[model samples]
Target: MTTTVVGVDGSPDSDLAVEWAAADAARRHRPLHIVHAYLSPFVAAQVAVPTSGGFEPVLRAAAEGTLGAAVARASSVAAGLDITTDMPAGEAPAALLDAARRAALLVVGCGHAAMAGLLPGSVSRAAVHHAACSVAVVK
Candidate 1:
């Protein structure tokens, strides 16, 4: 069965992207996977007190929260849609591309307006160029 994947960074625009993806998935009757990739650098800055655990717990918690919220947002638009969460440790664009392999559609946010031509977030660029499936850039 084809699946839908949405890349979310917890930004308001990404939240909107999630909503769009969910609606599309519901219309297609495909499972939706909401992904939030947290790079080590982002996590390092997010954590002030370092631990041997290397910020796993902190990052994991944030990923869970973000992915969960995205799923909730999806559910709000389409109740009982098949939803899953993927919180991977990697660069955002690369992680999204990996997820795209099995996706029927991939959705991402254009941090800047489409009139800007290119997105403020690099993941949008990667998704446009490298997605193995259909791509949607929500501004």
Candidate 2:
């Protein structure tokens, strides 16, 4: 069966997307694949904090935690549903699009309307426009 793929970042909207994707995967009788893309510490440190030897491990741990929470949330929504997770080594939109190549549907979360005017976030917008499969932007 074609799997349902969802992107998560630990935000409230991401939680909603996880719930929606879990339910959809259950209804479709397909597996749910959760993806959380994180940048390399070298790149992330440039954008987030000062470069340090300890930063990489923290980034990896945070990404794993995000995936774990998403898995738990999805499981709560659909008990007994098959679920898998990934932490791809790249940007969010590209990773999601790559994963979507083998997916039945790609799901992403949309933050508050004020955050991006009338459009969805960059990752969601990219998926909505570029994913080979159907895309869902859950708010």
Candidate 3:
């Protein structure tokens, strides 16, 4: 079955989006897929560091923690809900879009437009404009 996919970034807005996506998945009888993409400065700079140490470990740990928190939040919203998670290492918007390739809905969090600006964050804006399925921008 097509899933309901949500992108998380360890922000309160993302937590809210996780909750919303979980509930929506339950209501629609679809699995919930959570994505947390880690953009590494090392990769962007084309600097290869040993996997044993440096930014790689730190970023992976942080990404795992974020995904774990999101899973707990989602479970709290919908007990026994079928859920899966992906921690893709790349740009947030691209990772989220790829993860939602077969999704029925793509959910993302955005800061308050008034506070951040008149426009939603780049990731959310990209998802809304480019996602193949319906997009939900939860503030």
Which candidate has the top score in TM-score? 3
With candidate 3 superimposed using the best TM-score fit, by how many Å does residue 88's alpha carbon deviate from the native? 0.6
Write one digit per residue (lDDT tens) for candidate 1, span 16-115: 9999999999999999998888544444555543644666676678778888889889999999999988877766787889999999899999774222
Looking at candidate 3, the ten consecutive residues that score lowest on lDDT are 111-120
Q: Over 4 Å off in model 3, which ranges?
A: 41-43, 46-52, 112-120
Error of 1 at 137 (Å): 0.2
Query: Please, what is the TM-score per model?
Result: 0.85, 0.86, 0.87
CA lDDT of each candidate?
0.82, 0.84, 0.84
Separately for all candidates shown, the number of backbone clashes (residues 3 or more apart, or on different chains) is 0, 0, 0
C-alpha RMSD by candidate, in order: 4.5, 3.9, 4.0
Residue 32 shift from truth in candidate 2, angstroms: 0.3
Would you give me the overall lDDT of model 1?
A: 0.82
* Model 1 lDDT, residue 124, Cα: 88
Name the lDDT value of residue 77 in candidate 2: 95
1-139 per-residue lDDT for model 2 (tens digits): 8999998878899899999999999999999999987554336545564445555567778889989999999999999999999998667778889999999999999864221222348778899999999999998
